[model samples]
Target: MSVTSRTRFVNPRLGTYFGIFVSSLLGLLMLLLIFEELGTAEPLLRWAMLLGPIILYAAIGLSAPTREPIEFFAAGRRVPAGYTGLGIGVAAMGATGIVAITGVFFLIGYDALCLMIGGLAGFVIMTVMLAPFFRKFGSFTVPSYLGRRFESRPVRLLAAGLMAVPALLMLAAELRVGAAAGGWLTGEGQGVVILLMVATFVVTAVLGGMRSLTWAGSAEAIAAVLALLVPVTIVAVMVTNFPLPQLTNGPLLRALMHSEAAQGLPIIDAPALQFALPGEGMAHIAKRFTAPFGAIGPMAFVVTILTVLTGVAASPWLIPRVTMTPGVYETRKSLGWATVYFGLIMLTCAAVAVYMRDFVMDIVKAGVPSSLPEWMQRLVDLGFVAIDSAAPLNYLSFAFDRDSVLLSLPVAAGLPAVFLYFAAAGIVAAALVGVSATASAIGNVIAEDVVNGFSWEPLPRDGRLHVARIAMAGIAVAGGAVALVAPTDPLRLLLWSLALAGSTFFPVLVLSIWWKRMNDFGAIAGMASGFAVAVLTILAGEANILGIDGALASILGLPAGTLGAVLASIATPQPSRSVLELVREIRIPGGEVIYDREMRLLRLKSRERSS
Candidate 1:
């Protein structure tokens, strides 16, 4: 009956209590937002709801046991499987990814599933090829491991440079998504919102680094999952009297199919499509909603999947989830758990996509202008939905921005006022997770690879941590600045990140791990030659390279990179004996450190002196 005993009895699990408290807080906020619907600045309410989840996540991140380099960079390498899985899942799906991927189904058809499957394939690649090796090799950052293993400083610097492209681009894209959500909810300018969001992200990210992300990621997973589920659940219940869209979407799908038959809607060549062209009285192709390869052909379909898997496998941010685990075995086990979490998001994305398509067309089929929601009007104002003189909504189609599909869903479905606000808030939080993680990765590479590499004066522990913090801040600020000046397409930016990762890093990483004879020249040749080809291919395709289009754009990079690597390795001299010996030890799994030449020599001297 002592105070300590009483305290333990009263709070059996702080986590459960914390969950109950957060849920109650969110409920109260939702009710308050609902009550304030009687004429006021909605952004003020939006800012509150959005900041609620974010602030909590930031607090959680800051609470990590991070004081040393190991804790700061790898979260003491003790992250649990559950949270790691959730963090990886949320980071992979990304905020822009959610909107963009779901839009793919509506804009195209079953073809969208390829990206989802391909993304999942990346995890499979990691499990079989990369994750175990990284966990076994044991390093804080990708570049660090590569530089040490290859005994090449240039390799580390160049690796950091290659990853920076997608990491920085993705960070800018996520901020832009956040700005859009903020602007929509708060009625603030996107530019102004970008500044605020950058501050918010830095506050959340600067705390505890990798350690903070471990816990914050779980909370973020919940917010993002809810954001997707709430609308789909509501819409499913409304249309089919079922809460789970995946199980009960048959009727909803049928309704969409029936609606598609009746309309002369414009056909969208989905893969490269910008806006659904409002054609001048052309016969609409009665394309099936479940049609195969909607805009892209067979070759492109194959290429898209390969590219996504490669991209997913290659993403620098994602690999660390494995590196942060306690052991190599745990890293493998965690990937399985991570795959399950990823599968959940993939399922939700697929389900929500069909529902969005169904919801839009059903509204069209009813031919009821009065039933048209205010969000539809918003879409029209934003030019996503076009109007005609005779019809209520002349047509609704994408105009470059695919995010409009998700943005307009709440309004198009006419959910409760508060539900709409919550939906947007969830998306904003999801995007925040992606950008924060990207910023951290970009910062880590700069600090760990480029800055930390300068051994002119080895930094103290405090100096190293300080450099890391400054790098995080600098990357976040730079990404925000980029967002303001030249905001790129969310989906395209994401693809570029994935494509660059896959083509440039994927081949080199795979060869480096499994092939022992792979020398520095071979590694350099593979990454550089392959990266140049991949980037050029992407640019050429984007520029309609020789007027060729479709899946033809994808097959060149990985193969060329692989071939370049293999051939160069054959032509180059074998690595030094010390390098080969190190490679053998890297394949093992354990918590013990394997000493290098310097450490071994010092140990030998100490033993001799003792004797």
Candidate 2:
């Protein structure tokens, strides 16, 4: 596909332009509000930060006249391989993983880093092994693929519910982060920030639908990369001045030197690096060089594999990318680009954490005000400060305090214009990308999965579009409500979402794709079992259930559910031959027909065969 073809098709309507213009103006106004409230040195810097992404989104909305709004949701089978790949990479490496994961690395040390590397490796494996198959299958949504594969509406509905739950949770977390950032910038309550953020998603989705989201998402992804990179580069330059090499030479040697200097009483022959400062500790050094495992552990490893596989195998978002592109080869090429970009973006997140650790620490030392919002003060008190450590960093701890840390860092840095600009942009990009993707996810489920499940009839294209917009608004409103009542600990909510996905959907998705023996009975049982285990584990406060942490629990939980389902299926009668055939067809390569077309064809052929 040509580059121009991949770009958004414009809507000539003045109202659309007006909507875009209004949104941009509101964003500018919000930025100014935040700057004034925060008493930051670079208040005007907020305008560029807010205006850039808003303008970009508006431009996308303006393109709606030429392009169908559904394209924003699914890219209408027209996206080029390169753009699709980039979009996928950006979409996956969203605020949840990039910002949240970095905070985890900073807190835990090298162990967390190791875990992250393990997770990435799992993604790589999925890319080579599972992504190809998913690309070949060419279904828009996972549930659509499931419905086709099983020839059971119940299965599709069930899968949709599963997918929707996690997606919503993720959306909420994204909003929480965005609102917190806005509050910090504006010194307004988090409530106001949340309302604005949620409103953005509603208006954009309502106006341009998927077409707008896709173009906006792509543009936001680019902005995100720059936003994350600028501040990281700045901090990296600053940290290079520290005596890093000397700190990591040898713990024993350092201890002896310290003892000789008689600065303080040495506690241990070689103190664990976790006890020292960012640049001075062995733990900090380990974190920079190693990967650590905290909550994700082996379970995380399995979940990561599952997430990537399912993402490729059955995700609606990816399906549209395949169809939108002109051809299969182009789609594959796009996937390749996406993989590289995803890896690069994830790595950049780690680098940013390393550079920002000291900056965070400085903020904590500055002391939080009692009058500040509870979330902000908690972040400071909880030591949201990242410490340079040799051990894999614990991102979870920092994640727990992310809202506060992100808000105060600029101020701690004396509100440098450049840093604030980058931070603000990153916050907005992360929120917009996250909310938009979520809105798309919810819309896909409702339009293609839930609506079709009731009867094998596809909703009219326009009706489907209408339902999607409604779903988007509903989701945003729900997320805003959750943010209103959510815990101050941002990381806790994030971990809960990850853990839920890892334990429930992660296991079921992996087994369903890889194991042919996984019947519907097995799938149902497995999903239920995995979800139960995850919820129970969280309630019980057990970090490692059955000696599995991180992504491993999901891997383990899959077996538990799969075994139950397998046993049940074995005891029951087998599904009909038609059902089996449907499964095979759904899994086959180049099954490019839309849900409605495919269903009609299947019924017609079935009647003919019977006759």
Candidate 3:
């Protein structure tokens, strides 16, 4: 073979090989550490494991030049579709999702399945209604698309600010989970571990930027899937040997049912296993499976779905993958593979939840510590101790409540090295994805809204890249700070993010894209109203917002914002002729060609015309 052929065959990119090698070594080291510290590794091992991916990503970022920061931030618009799809999946599977499902399972027995079905339904809605639209618009940020469609600079700025708040909150919650995990693994002060984790994430994210983040995220997704599979598969086999129905019909189930039935309810109905029912069985499931919806749930779920939809629709993180390929068909093909990969991971998470719920009571009976802290002891009284016995690893359960225990599973599994590797990967992915969105939004704000409106000196690519880097660094710091200050409840933080997104951006984005009559006045009114309602709901302790709970809040919040926008649109005068014309341009398919051409012409105009 020729030299070029051999180089291609060998996969000459040193970074790719180096990443794999380092990850393997780190995994091995963590395994060794786990064995050494067995029963007592809690937080120490967790913190140490976080180092590997950080170093790996930082090395990648520092080795590359800073001039093409957009490429670094957005993968040079050249990411493979498979990677982008996987990246999206991984980002979605943050610490909160893992912890929440596990906690829910421990509390509700098998009835939590309904909630999972609900979530899957939401995802289906996203894929069918929202994904194609996003794929078509092809913008770098959600706000940018809004700016173009509505011809309103203020609206775009408001969207950016709204998106940033929730993103930061979610990021903070994830970091807190990691920190708590570290505390469990090491048996140390949570504050110290949290601080270290925060610092590490901020430093690594600031240094590595987006290019490094993409590669790291892909690897993390693979590793997490594998780790989750091992335990879930083991539990699946175990469950097959002791099926849920059989167990429920045995002595333990009968005893509980008999005792509780005297209170006017039966505890062991066949259908109750599949869905929620009334009486003692129902009460038990309700206590464990349901959350307080109030106003928070509806607001949160709606906002989350909208935020994710917007992010996926306009994020530069995915844009690079589409641009890397030569055709849309290839992009779609990659997306299909990505979806499959993501689905499998999500399935593993659900299975793990089921397994944990099946055995949680037994674990708690066996693992509850007499010497636990007062708060932890109360948790035990409240049935939180069950989680310790549910899973093979029970350290977090023995030490904390169900909520905290769930957050600490990555550490509890005696797989700190594995978790650390996963965390490092997750952090990089989140930072890169978040920063890319932020940078693109900022770029659009400046290039199209700010600079264009004022006719000031347009920023060059190099300058734009510089600004993006600075913005990214700031974002990392902000995210870290929020992580430090926020409540340790991952679910709560997630709800907050989702509610904010739904109330502020979801309604406006959907309307702007599909409704031609959606003038700037209507868009602004809708967003502002949504924001106010969500904030008030959260403040009033109605975190779940609706009867469907936190998981469904995002979907429910859509109408509140949409209504506000529609009513305002009708109340306000129609948009100016120029604004209506702008919407027409945006509605056109392959609108990106116009944007690309405009950018090129602007660049050319700035340079000398001489041949």
Candidate 4:
């Protein structure tokens, strides 16, 4: 690629434009928030803040050129490494993970850190074990790769089937998250908020498919980073007299632990002291709070980390990102960016979790809701912040919603109201980016692996675009409807989704790349066993028949997949020489399919060479 071509195709200027645009828009939104604080917020402006960014991102998505199949499916395989990494990092984090992990960290304690650790490890696994080889094979998604590698329709079908549950559930959950975040700004119900978010997905997916989503996701990552970092930095300066929370949190933590109520409340002896928290890790609390793996035992911790690693590798939409990069070197480099981006966010979440835990608790100890400001009252009305004047433990038992932490952080901490606006915007962007990626992945999988596989009848280029858009729209609406009652906890849903992905896809992809002898029968057996065990275990546990918990559910499936594939491969017929030869070319890079009509000629040459 020449310098001009690289600039045109791979090196987009959107990153700089995104920063300028979001900063200005955020300033306007913050002005609205400040006016609202003074009781002068215009309904039109509030609606704009809630819906405007979504519309703008949708427009950006539409602007991408997508008249071609490659544009629609793979973003023309020209996305620069930096953008791809940013997209992956942002997409991997859902609204639930954003809110819940931080909330859990502060609200519960150290267990949240385990997820933070595991999350970073996941990118490393993807980079080293999976990233380079897949791009060389040149497929858009993991399921597509499975179909070709195994040379079996059923194998692809199985992979697609496993994909549906997580993709749909995650999209639905994110829609709810977007709705809830919008509710913070608009004071609307989850259902009403979802309508706007769902519409955004529809318009964008229909406009340019993956080409648009790639840029949009990169923008969202930028928005999320700014929103998170600014607040945490401000809070750190205010509390600890420093700006960097990650480094300056130790003194703040001690202050939070030592800070006490001006007046005491009568206490009842509950399982854990409900009245005046003596700081979970403070001297008086049960077993010092320095525990690395909260609630989950060490075994569960191992399982959780391994599952995250496997799940990251199995990620369908994320894998497509690698395929779109300019080359193996770029793909590898993108993973580094992904790791750095992911770490920055994860670290911010941990700092915010610790900071917010103290922030919320201190507020509670200081006679919440009643003594709180107007912003707290608004939050109370929205149900994220509530105070029971009649509670037994003074304000100690006051309800503080964990999932609302990210959205409510600015307001709860008494920072400038604009932080709230930017935080809400970031929340919407993160949720939408994640949902659109999954929706796009599902649509592409159906279009290529299932619909196109039915007949050698190559799907017309336009037909692929049409079906993919319809598939995405259907998923968005269906997911929105499901979001009405979807679990309030996005992390719980995320955990199961990752488990399912790790169990079914990761083992197969690994074996296919490393062990060339693995045949279709082995791949099918591996996937089925893993999928069956993981799904059944989760189902049984959910229905209350089995004593199984979700913490390590993926652990039960990983071995099943590996063993099934290995044992079944030994029992089944070996893969033919032609398939092995193609695998060899795939293992090495640089096979040019010279012409559309000459693919068969290349296959014949491979067979002849094998013979």
Which prediction has more favorable lDDT, 1 or 3? 1
Superior by TM-score: candidate 2 or candidate 4: 4
Q: Give the higher-lDDT candidate: 1 or 2.
A: 1
lDDT of 1 by residue, 33-68 (tens): 566776555656677777777677777666664667
**Residue by residue across 1-611, what tens digits does model 2's lDDT show?**
65443234423353464466445644554565476668856545555566556666656655653234336455555565666666666655356566655655554433344334534554454455445455455566667666655566777888788767656666777777777666665667889878877766665667667666666666666666666655545444454543332132233233333332332212222122111212211222222223233323444434545533433333333334544454455666777777777677666555544434544333333333322334334334535433323232232123334333333344443434545656666676777777777657777777778866776655655776777778778878887887688663444454445555555554455555565555666566666776676556555444443443333334444456556666766766676676556546545645454443565686677779889
Put down candidate 3 lDDT per residue, 1-611, tens digits, no spaces.
64332112222464576567456745655674565457645344444445554455445445544355445444554556566666565555355555554455544444434334433443444454444454454444565556656766777677666666666666666666655555544555656665554454344444444555555555545544444454444334444644332122234444333332333322332221121212111112333222323112334333344544443433322333443322344455555665565456545554544434334334434444443334343434534343234443332343324343332333333333444334333433343333333333343343433444333224666665555556655555566667667654665675566566656775676677678788878887887777776666565444433333332334435566788899989988887887776556645544354334455676677775543
Worst 10 residues of 3 by lDDT: 273-282
Whole-structure CA lDDT of model 4: 0.71
The pairs that clash in candidate 4 are none
Model 1, residue 97: distance off in Å is 0.4
TM-score winner between candidates 2 and 3: 2
Off by over 4 Å in 2: 1-42, 65-73, 235-331, 356-415, 510-517, 542-556, 582-611
- Of the two candidates 2 and 4, the one with more favorable lDDT, higher being better, is 4
Per-candidate TM equals 0.87, 0.72, 0.70, 0.87
lDDT (0 to 1) per candidate: 0.70, 0.55, 0.49, 0.71
